[model samples]
Target: MSVDRFCETMCIATIAVMFGCVACITIKTPVGAISGIQETLTVDGRPYRMSTFLGIPFAESTAGENRFKKPITKAPFLSTFDATKNPMACFPSHLGGEIKYGKYVNFSEDCLNLNVFVPHSFEKNVSLPVMIWIYGGSFVEGATAIFPGEGISAFGDVIVVTVSYRLGMFGFIQSADGKLPGNLGLWDQHLGIKWVHDNIQAFTGNPNDVTVFGESAGGASVIFQSLYPGNRGFFQRVIAQSGSALAYWAVHATPNAEPLIAKKGCERAPDPVKCLRALTPRQLQDDDTSAWQPVIDRDFLLASPQEIIFGNSSHTQNARNFFASLDLMTGANNFDGAVYFRDVWPFIFKTTDMNTFNLTRGQFTGIAIPSIIADAIKPKNHNIASIMGKLLDFEYTDWQLPNDSATLLFSLTNMSNDVGFFYPVVSTVKGHSSLRKGKTYLYELSAVPTTHTLQTPNWIQGSNHADDIQYVFGYPLYAGPRSTGNYTEEERRLARGMVTMWTNFAKSGDPNQPEDARRFTNATWAEYDLNSQSFLHFTNQGALPGSRFEARRMQLWLDLIPTIALMETPQAHGTGTVHVPEIIIGK
Candidate 1:
C-alpha cells in the first residue's frame, strides 16, 4: 500500500516520542481522553522529549456485527475520547485505486486504533522498554496510520507503539464449513498485542518489556505473533524487518469461501456472515483479494507452517510449545527484490502498450514460467517447471545492470526478491538459530534511498522496498547539501545509527550495547549461529559490518525451494543437499 509512497517518497516522518504538551493534558484511559503533543529526537546531536498518544482506543467498534468477529478490547468509555485525531485506515479492500496512502488516510471500519509514544525523562517509578509497530500491506493493505511513532519514543528511551489490523477481505475469511473462524487478521493482531499487554503499564510501559516489530506483512506478523500459545504475555522481542514466516505470500489459505463470498453479493446468502457484513466498504474494497489471507485454522492458524517450523506440531506437546523464548532480530532489504521489480516493467521492455521491445526467451518464458509455477508447490520433479526456470535463470543472471533490459529487469527482480523477501528472511534466521531458546540477530539493509517511489529508470541501485522507513523512524535528517528540511550528514549518521539500533533492541536483548554501540561498532553484532554467518551490513556506502560465509546461492534457495524454505530441522538435515519435504502446497 504505501511503502514510503510506493518506493518513492514525499516526506512524512514525524513520530519520535512525545513526552509533553504545552497545555492539553487530560489523562484517564481505560478507553478515553488522551490529549498530547511535544515531540523531538535528534540523538547524537541531541534533542530528546517524547509523549505523543494520539487516537488511543485499543479496540471496540469493529463496526457492524463486529465485522467478521474477534477483537473487542476497547470497552469502558465515558466520553472525551478525542485523543487528538489520526486513526482510521483499515478498509483498504485490497488496494483498489492502488491505495497509495489513500488521500492521506482516514478510512475506517472503526479501525482498531493504537499509537502511544512516551519518553520525556521517565519517572512515575520508571518503566520503559516497549515497541510495537506492524505495518506491511500483503495482509491486504497496511495501516497503523502509516507508522510515525515519534522518533523511537524520543531516541530510544522507549515506549512506542503503532497498530491497526483487518484488511482485504475484511481481515481474512474462512468457512467451507468452519463456521467462520479464519484468522481475524491475526485476531486483529492478537487484539492489538493484547491491548498492549494489558494496557502498557498506564503508558510508562514495561509489560515484561515488550518488543514486537514488523515490515512486509508486518514482518510476517512478527512470525505469526511468535507462533501463539495464546501469545504468552503479549510480546517480548521480535523485529523481522523484511518479512518471514516462510513467505510464499506468507501462508495463503483459500479452501474456497464460495468464490470469496461470491465477490460480496454474499454468494448463496442466508447469512453468509450476515450477508457479508452488509456490504459497502466500497463493496468490500472491490473483492478478489484471492480469497483473503492466512488460513489453516483450528483457531488462529493452528498448524502447518510446515507444522510450526518443523517440530511438526499436531498440537503443542513438542515443538517447544511453538518456540517462545522469543529474542529475535531478523532482517532483509538488499533491494527487497525491488518489490517484485515494479511489475516486470512491461515484461522487461518487450513492451506492451500494444507490443514491441521484442519479447522472446520463449516469450519471456511464456510469461514468467507459468506464473512462477502457479505460485508454489513444486519439487515433485518432472522437471519442476523446467527446474525452476533453470534455477532462477541460474542465480539471477546479472551481466551488470543498465542494459539487456536492465539485465532482464535485474533477473526478475532478484527472483521476486528471492522468493518474496530474501528466502524468508534467511529461513527465519535458520529457524531461530535452531532454537536454543532465543538469541538471534542478523541484518542486511544496503541503504541508498535518497527518494525513489518506483521511478524505475536510472539503472535502479540499492535500498528498495520500504526504503528503511526514514532510517528506522527518526525521520528525514539526512541533511547534506545543507538542505533546509534537514537530514543529511549521511542522513544524520544513518538516523542516529538506526534509532539507536532500534532502541537498543527494545532496551536490551542486545543490539551491540554501550549506548547502541557508540555510533556503530567497536564490534559485537553476532549471534546468528550455525557458525559465523554474522551479519550487520547496514550500508549506503558506510560499509564495514560484513562477514557472510554462507551462500552456495543461499544453498540453492534453502535446498531447492519447496516454496521458500524454512521447515528443515531434524538437526539441520545433515548439512543440506536438498531432501526435505514432508508437506507443502499452494496459495
Candidate 2:
C-alpha cells in the first residue's frame, strides 16, 4: 500500500472511533445500572436525573384468550432484557403513529410499559413525590417515551413516570351480544396505577403522595381514575389538561341510556366474546374506530362519571371523592378539538372542501344531518344514522352549522373540551364544594405566541389544543415558545412555574401556599362555585379571573343532549354491566 493511502485510512478509522465514543457517552447514564438513554442533570441546585425505559411491560399482551380481559401484571424486570435501549413501542402501531411528525419507535401489542425519572441523591428517606403522566391520543394513540414527556421529566426534581397503555380496538372493545364487555383499556391504566401505588416507593417515591396527570385522553384518565370506584385510593391528587369525563364521548347524559353499540353499528354479535376475539387487531381497529370509549361497567366503573357529577348516582362517594375530597386541577388547551373537527368534518359531511376542509350551512343541514345527532348520541348508536336521528330533532339535529367550518369546528372542538373536559372538572369542583372536601382552583390559558411551531392552519397563534403540553413539559418546539424573538426564557419560566406548582400539589393536597396561591400575576385563581363559575385566565399580560370561562359553551350542550355522571362505588350503581370480580377457584 502507498504511504499516502495508509495515512488516509488511519485517519478515517480514528474519526470513526471518536464518533463511536460520543454516541456511547450520550446514550449511557452516569448513575447505577438502570438503562434506556439516561441523562444526568440538576434541578433547583439538586442533582436531577432522567432516563427512558422503553417497553417495560405493565401488562401481558391482550391477544388470543387474553383479549378483553383485565391487564395481567408482568413479573419484575428481567436481567436478560437491556433496560438501557428504547424498546420497540408495543405493536399494531407505534407512538405518534401515522402522524406527519411521527418518530420511529419500536411499537408492539406487548407494549404496556412506563418510563421513570428521578432526582439524584435526594436524602434516601425524603420519599419525594412521584408524578405519573398518562399521555393523550384520544385514548387511541400515544406513547410514554415521547419528546415532551422526556423534556418534562428533565424540568423537575421529583420522580416522573410516563406510561403507555393499550390503544384503539386493542384497548377498548364493546361486545355486540353483551357477553364480552369494553373498557379494557381503562382497566389497563388502573392496573398500571396499582403497580405504581404498590411499587413507586421502591424507587424512592412517595406512593401515597402520587399525582396522576395527563392531557387530552390522559386528562380524561385522571378524571376517570378519580371517579371510577375501582380506582379509588390510587392517587391523592389529580391534574387533567384538555379532557374531562362530563364531556362528549364520555357518557350519555341520561340514565339507563341505550347500551354502547359494537363495531359497525352492531349491538351484539352472534358469538360476541368469541367473535370479537377471533378478529385480527387490524380488523378490530378499522371496525371499531367510530366509538372508542370507556364504558360504565357497574363492576369496574360503578356509575357513569356524568351521573356522579350530577349527584344522582347510588355511588355518591365516587362523585364525592373524585370531585370533592381530592385536590384536583384540570384545564384545556384552546386548540384541543381542532384535529378531531378537521378529520371528522369531511367524513360526516358530503360537500367538505379538501383544501380548506370547512363545512357549509347547507352541508350541515343536509348531508351532515346525521353527523350532529350521531355524535350527540354516541355508543348506543355509534355509526347508526337512523338511531341517532330518532333521538334528536331533524332541524336541531343538523341545525345551521357555523357559516365557516372554522367557526363550527371551533365550537365542536371546544364542545368536547367544555362538556367533556371543562364541565366535568367544574362539576367535580362544585360537587367537592358541596361535600366540603377542599378548595378547587380553576384556570384558563390563552397565550398565543407566534413562536411555537404553528402546526395548525387556523391561526399561527393562540393557545391551540395540546399547546399546554409543550409548555408544561418545557419541550423545545420548532418556533420556540414566543414570536417575541427572546428565545425560550419565558417558556422556561412558565415550565418551571407549572412543574413547581404540580410537584408542590403532589407533595401536599394544595398546589398553592398562602403566598403563592394564584397561578400567575395576571390571575387570582378562584374556587369554583355553582352560582359564580370562574377560572383564572393565563395570557401574556398575566393571569386574572374570568366568569363562566368555559361553562357557558358547555351549558348549551346540556340543553342539546342529556347525560349521566357516575361518582360512587361500584356496588352502588346497581347492575349496569360493570366489570365485577369473578370467583377465583384455586387462587
Candidate 3:
C-alpha cells in the first residue's frame, strides 16, 4: 500500500475507535502515541486546548439556480471532513478590506462555511452558551476565517462560532416581484444559526443560549435580524457595537435591484429572473457597479424601518414582538464620525472622479446637509440650492473660531456621526427599554488603543468607527490585532475588560449579572432607559457610569434643523413640505 493511503486508513480507523459514539472525543494512548483519530491542537508546544473545527460547510452552493435565493442547508458529512482550513469566501468580496492595508485574501462563490470553537475538555452534556460572530463590510466584504474563536471560547468557557455568508451583488440583488428574494446574505446567516442550533449539541453547545454579535455593518445586521419577524426566537441576546438598523448607512431606504438587473442585461428579457440565472458570478461582480444593499423586501421586512420602529406599522403595534424578551447591549465610539468626514473638510465639500458628476455650488450645497432636509428645502427649477446650506452654515460653522482650520472639519464630522451612528444607537436603546421586559445595557467606547490604524489627527481621540472590534477581539489575538505601531499595558487591560463584558452578556441576559465576569470586578453597568439615559463609558480604568452628552448634540439634527425649517418653510421655497416631522428625535 502507498504510504499516504496507509496513513489515511490508519487515521480513519483511529477515528472510528475513539469516536464510536456521536459526541466528539479524542483519546491519547499511554505509549506516547496518538490514538485512532485526528489528534491534538496547539499554538506552539503549550496548548490553549480548544477543539477547533474550521471551514465546515453550512449551506449548499449559492451558484446556478441558487443565485439570489435563500440558503439551503448542507447535508451531513458522510466521512471525516478536514475543517482545519478556511473555505473560500463568497466571490468578488473583499476580505474585510485587507487589500487597502496591503493584504491579500482568497475569494470565491462556494464560501458558505462556518468555524466552531470549544474548550478541549468540553462534553456534549455541558451546554455552554454560544456566541456567533457576524462581520461588517457595508454588505460588501468580510470573512469568518480572519477572526479566531478559540481564545474567546476558552476565556468565557462558552462555545464560539464564526460564520461566513454571501456578500455584494451575489447576496443582495433584489427582484421587483419579491420572487427572487434579495436577503440571501441574511438568509445565509439565518441558516448558519439554525445549523448551529441543530448540530451544536454534538460539539457541547447550548442551542437555547445563543447570542449574535458584531461591529459596524455586522452590528447593523444584528438589529436587522432581530427586528425581522422570521428571526424572533433565533437568538436570546444581542451586542451591537457601533451600528444600528436605523443608521442611514446601516440599511438603505431605497431598492437598487432594477438597476442591478439592467446591468446584467435582463431589462428587456421576457423573464428577468431567467436572464439573471444565465450569467456567471464574475459577470455580476465585474465593473464594480452593483449598489447591493438591503431594501424593504415585504417578505423579510414587511415595511420600512421607519414605519416599523417609529409606530407607523400597518398592523397594531402591540401585535409585533420587538425584543419582547431579548436583552440588548449596544453602543458607539466617541469620535465615531471622524472617518465619515476624513476627506471632505475645509469647504471643498465633495468631489467625484467622473467628469459628468460635477455639480454647481447650489446643487452641491443640498448634498452637504443631512439628506432628509436637502431636497425638501432646495429651490426647484433654479438649477441651484441655498436654504439648507445657509441653515447648516449657521448651525455647524463656528463664527467665533472661523479662522481655525480644524474647527469646521470637526463640526461636520460631529454632525455626520450623530446623524448616522449615535442618534440611532440611543434611539434603539430607548426603544428596547420601552418595549421589552428584559434588561437593556448601553456603552460608549472611548479608549484610544495603540492598535487603531486609521491615520486621524491626535485631537480626534476616543474611538473611531469600528475601533472597539480590536479591543473586544483582543490585541494579541491568534492572528494579532491591527496595531498602530506601538503597544501599552493600559490598552491590553481595556481589551480584557471589553471581551469580558461581551462574553458576560452572551452567557447571561445581563452583562453585570454574570457572576465573576472580568468586567463586573469593577463597576455595575446601569440599565439604560428613558429616565436617566445612562451608559457605561469604557476607558482604561473600566466600565463606569456615564451621563449621555448626545441629547443636546442630536437636538441640532432632530429638533433645531427641522424646526427652523418649519419656521422658515415658505421663505426658502414654497415646495418645502412638512412630511419631515417624522425625523424628530424620539422622546
Q: Write the per-residue lDDT of candidate 3 for residues 466-539, one digit (tens) a residue.
A: 77876776543333334343556676567656667778888877776465544433777778886887888888
Comparison by lDDT, 2 against 3, better one: 3
Find the candidate with the highest lDDT and give its number: 1
Tell me the TM-score of each prediction against the true structure: 0.34, 0.74, 0.81
Candidate 2, 1-587: lDDT as tens digits? 74434443443454346334211111112122233333444443344444434454667777788876778887654232234445445333222353522364655557777766655433246577788888777666776656335444545456787777776656765554444566777787888888778766655677887888887778877777777656667777888877676555554222211232244334466655666567665555452234566766666566656556544444555554565667777766555544444455556654344446665556544554455444543334334445334333332322453466655444445543453445555655555556666556666767664454324545424676677776666443222222233435555456555655666566666555433634445344566666676666666555667777655445544433333211112344455333321100000
The lDDT of each candidate is 0.66, 0.56, 0.65
| Candidates by lDDT, descending order | 1, 3, 2
Candidate 2 stretches with Cα past 4 Å from truth are 1-38, 42-48, 77-81, 88-102, 121-125, 147-150, 176-178, 251-280, 312-323, 349-370, 377-425, 449-455, 476-488, 514-524, 550-555, 558-587
17-67: candidate 1 lDDT, tens digit per residue = 222323233455555444555444554457766556666767787778888
In candidate 3, what residue range of length 10 has the lowest lDDT sum? 28-37
> What are the RMSD figures for all models against the true structure?
22.4, 9.2, 7.3
Against the hidden true structure, what lDDT does model 3 obtain?
0.65
Model 2 poorest ten-residue lDDT run? 578-587
| Candidates 1 and 3, the one with greater TM-score | 3
How does candidate 1 score on lDDT? 0.66
